[model samples]
Target: MSSAMTNERLARLYDRIEIQELLYRYARGVDRKDWDAVRAVYHPDAFDDHGNYKGDIDGFIASLQQRHAHIEQSMHVIANCIIEFDTPDSALVESYFITYQRVLPSAGDARANYFLREPLADDEAVQGQAIGRYADRVTRRDGVWRIEKRAVIYEVYRGMPTIPGGRLRDNWTISSRDGRDPLELLRIELGLGEAR
Candidate 1:
């Protein structure tokens, strides 16, 4: 009986870790524009209700790609994740997230609609920030965990002018424009293939 209980605990711990990792990978995929990695974490029939955007997985993917097109840099941090198991293969999850993005000046008039930021001049850039919680229903299918549904609740959203000459890069590692970021390239070199 004690050994059986230990096994159950181990299984639960493993599930928790897998679910958390799924959320982290989702963030990484979005920041790096790695759509395949993002799609891999969701059910085919998944629905994402992201305030301004609401639709199935395919539409969600399209919206994501479109939304970030005019933005140059994006960073997302997920924290305070709480998970509750509904069944051996299903769980409810809530994860708090903060996202920071730098919108290019070329966005110009288009920024007013999607970005909700003021129009910028030819050489001006703006930074945007949002704080939200992702309430998700996650399920394990074929021994793999994925999001079945997700609703993003925003607590804060705003944009401001970036400080001039704020960029101070001292390292050689630069984030790639495509999904072939340095980390992914290194992982591939080590035979990891961009997934855990």
Candidate 2:
């Protein structure tokens, strides 16, 4: 192959990796409640439809903040991602996710009722699991790839009462919404400088 062809192939590979990272960032941002990180994943004029809500990116973020505030913690695991390039500057991406959320009973009487069949004990919480997919229109603008529009489809979900004492205790180092993740220790081990 010609050098130009090899370089083009390499560039496409890099684009694919960058797109995957953007998806990972989106999941981390949502789980960590880092609104800024969420914002960075999308274009300024992005649109989102997440089943329960549909609107512009700002409205989407606001709605998430309101809803997630009631939850103690969340984790979104991406199981599969497929990207189809439409052009050098645009792609269609689908990402499958399994999400787990732990919400306190105080979210609201109505919302709590959906999760708890009976009243939750003071020491217990509600755990929810969801299987879903995010279908996104991604575009490259100014040399950066970001989501231009997205639609979330939930395949199934269930909630159950969590057993008492099923949480970490006395762990000083934990993940944070402000970008502090215990996994950063890996950087130190690898002789890299301070982790951001």
Candidate 3:
């Protein structure tokens, strides 16, 4: 191939990688409750249709915060990211995700008192899983790719009583929701702190 064509192919590959990183960032932001990172994944005027909620980007973030507030822990895992370029400046993308959440037990709920060894009821504190796909319209603006619009399609949802003694023990290292993960210390030690 000619040098020009090779360069064009390389650029396209870079764009694809960047878009994938953007999707990963979105998942990390959601799991970590880093609203600023979530907001950065989209364009300033992006639109989102998340099944339970539909609105502009700001409204979407607000809704997420409200919904997540009642959860003890949450994680969003993204996979199968595919990007198809429609033009030099626009592309369509889809990412598959599985979201897991442990909801806080309601007040006076037997499950809330961990000391009790009674069997859990069907309606007790629960763990939930949502399998979904995110279809997005992405555009390149000022050489940066960001989501212009996104719609989530949930394929399945499951909720079950939390398993007895399922909680993690103190031995496990903890990750933080405020971007202060222990990995950050490693990053600083390895000269990766400047990259972020």
Candidate 4:
């Protein structure tokens, strides 16, 4: 293959990796409540249509913060990403996502801790999962790729039943929702910025 063709192919591969990284970063940022990281995934002028939220990045972030304020913990899994280049500097991306959240009755509630001996009742807490797809229009501007516009489509939502566990879960290392999470600490120690 010609050098130009090889370079083009490599560039496409790099763009693809970067786009996928954005999806994962979004998941990590939201789950960890790293708002800065979440903000980094979008362009300044971007618009988001996230069901209940349909506006600019700032509003979207505020909505997320408010919606998650009562949650004890959350986890988001992103998968099945499809990226299609519409132009040399623009692409359409779709990614399937599933999020599980441990909802507390109220912020700073003592019962938020896992009580292995007892089954969590619906009134005490709300354990649920949301399945959705993110359809995004991503563009490369000044050699950096970021989402220009995005639409979040909801597919399904269901509750996660509490399952009793033994001492293994008791000894598991805890991950915080803020910067104090174990992974965040390690990343910070490694000089990987304020948040990952």
Worst 10 residues of 3 by lDDT: 107-116
Q: TM-score of model 3 relative to the true fold?
A: 0.83
Give the Å error, residue 56, model 3.
0.6
> lDDT, candidate 1, residue 161?
70
Query: What TM-score quantifies how close candidate 4 is to the native fold?
Result: 0.86
The reply for model 2, stretches above 4 Å from the true place, is: 110-124, 163-165, 171-196
lDDT of 4 at 178: 66
Candidate 2 or 3, higher TM-score?
Answer: 2
Q: Of the candidates shown, which would achieve the greatest lDDT relative to the real structure?
A: 1
lDDT of 4: 0.82
- Model 2, residue 10: distance off in Å is 0.6
In Å, residue 64's CA in model 3 sits off its true spot by 1.1
Task: Encode model 4's per-residue lDDT on 134-180: one tens digit a residue.
Answer: 99999999998999999999998776434222113657898788679
Per-candidate clashes, comma-separated: 0, 0, 0, 0
User: After best superposition, candidate 2 residue 138: deviation in angstroms?
Assistant: 0.2
Give the C-alpha lDDT of model 2: 0.82
Q: Deviation in angstroms for 29 in model 4?
A: 0.6
Which digits, one per residue and each the tens of the lDDT, describe model 1 over residues 28-59?
Answer: 88888888889999999999999888989899
TM per model?
Answer: 0.90, 0.84, 0.83, 0.86
Rank by lDDT (best first): 1, 2, 4, 3
